[model samples]
Target: WRRGTNSIAVLGAPQVILYKFGHPSDAWWGVLPYWAGLLILSAPVGLTVYYFLNDHTPPKSTPLAAFLLSLAFISSCVWTDLIASELVSGLEFLGVSLGVSRSIIGLTILAWGNSIGDFVADTALARAGNPRMGAAGGFGGPLF
Candidate 1:
């Protein structure tokens, strides 16, 4: 059970690079997750970020900082995928236990997850004889 939980925690199999940023002078650690692995992983990162943001304040923006920030932003996308996969897995298990059809469960979950507004708008547009526009709108609606 512990092994399974640990395996699932690293769902995306992210690369394990050991980045050792020097510690901050002042002692201030933010709220931490209730997991030893996370504590080990995030302590250095949180300290590094604190060191950069508070202590070594940048007067002018550097390209390296921009690139690092972009990578951090991109990590959110990975987190989203991880969270969504867990949600879907839980929903699937519930459906199976409840003796419900997986297809029906999928349809219900997907419709709500993707938003019924997208379905209605896309359908209306496609029915009104513009499928390309409908398809484009369907894909683009979530961006806004």
Candidate 2:
């Protein structure tokens, strides 16, 4: 029932805030050590969405880009938290239904979820013909 390590914060920078997921403090048979790496996809702020709507990058003569960017960012924050919460609840429910303890779910299912991002990013970048940016993304990541 507490906030723990998030995807954007941890996959990007862990030393700053080493968070760990856990069930209720008194629950001895529930989950613990869950590493749910939640990530907000780039479609909200990606160039494709912007280009699809605006037909081009943000213009320098106006504040439209800044305005839209901020709007998207704020919306992202709201949804990310919601999605993360739902994910944990869903996983925990699944664990309970399957007769598996929460701790094991955290250690196994949640941990492997981190690699999903890596797989998607590699495929996306390669298809986009700018795979090098993926490397840069690895170093920079979605930390903003």
Candidate 3:
């Protein structure tokens, strides 16, 4: 993992390290997998971007632009992490009350968010050229 990416993992390192060392509980195991999965996935993305982008392109805008983009991406990830972590932390109650588990919530929320975004964006693009389509976009959509 890249040096910067280490900070992202550091966010959840305590619980994960503790759980791996033999702390056992359903919640502990539950949280561990999510943190581990996030750590594993995030490390590679940062490493890949760092290795490939490090020397390839000239600086754009200014050092500030680079800093801002990095901050933006990290902040976005942190917001997502916050939601996932909060939901996981409260999984037991949520699972019982909602009649579903953390894994199901994660799957459905992420899947539907992406699907909805794609549906909206695609329909928007498709309507971009036609006035009739654009006019219809506000009231009806792709199926219409």
lDDT tens string, model 1, 30-81? 4432244444655554445444443334314766356445544655666676
> What is the C-alpha lDDT profile of model 3 across 12-118, one tens digit per residue?
44444434443334343456554455556556545544454434453367663465466556656666776776766675466669788667866876557546854
Question: Top model by lDDT, which number?
Answer: 1
lDDT for 32 in candidate 3 is 58
Q: Can you list the residue pairs that collide in candidate 2?
A: 31-102, 31-103
Worst 10 residues of 3 by lDDT: 20-29
Please identify model 1 stretches exceeding 4 Å from their true place.
1-49, 52-60, 116-144
Give the candidate number with the greatest TM-score: 1
- lDDT scores of the candidates, listed in order: 0.59, 0.52, 0.54
Listed per candidate, the RMSD to the true structure in angstroms reads: 12.4, 16.2, 11.5
Residue lDDT tens for model 2, 1-144:
011212122232221122222222332335432232221233233333333334333344446446444544655665576678789899999999999999999989986785578767966986799778876776655452
Tell me how candidate 1 scores on lDDT.
Answer: 0.59
Q: Give the Cα error of residue 72 in candidate 3, in Å.
A: 6.6
**In candidate 2, residue 134 scores what lDDT?**
72
CA error at residue 3 for candidate 1, angstroms: 34
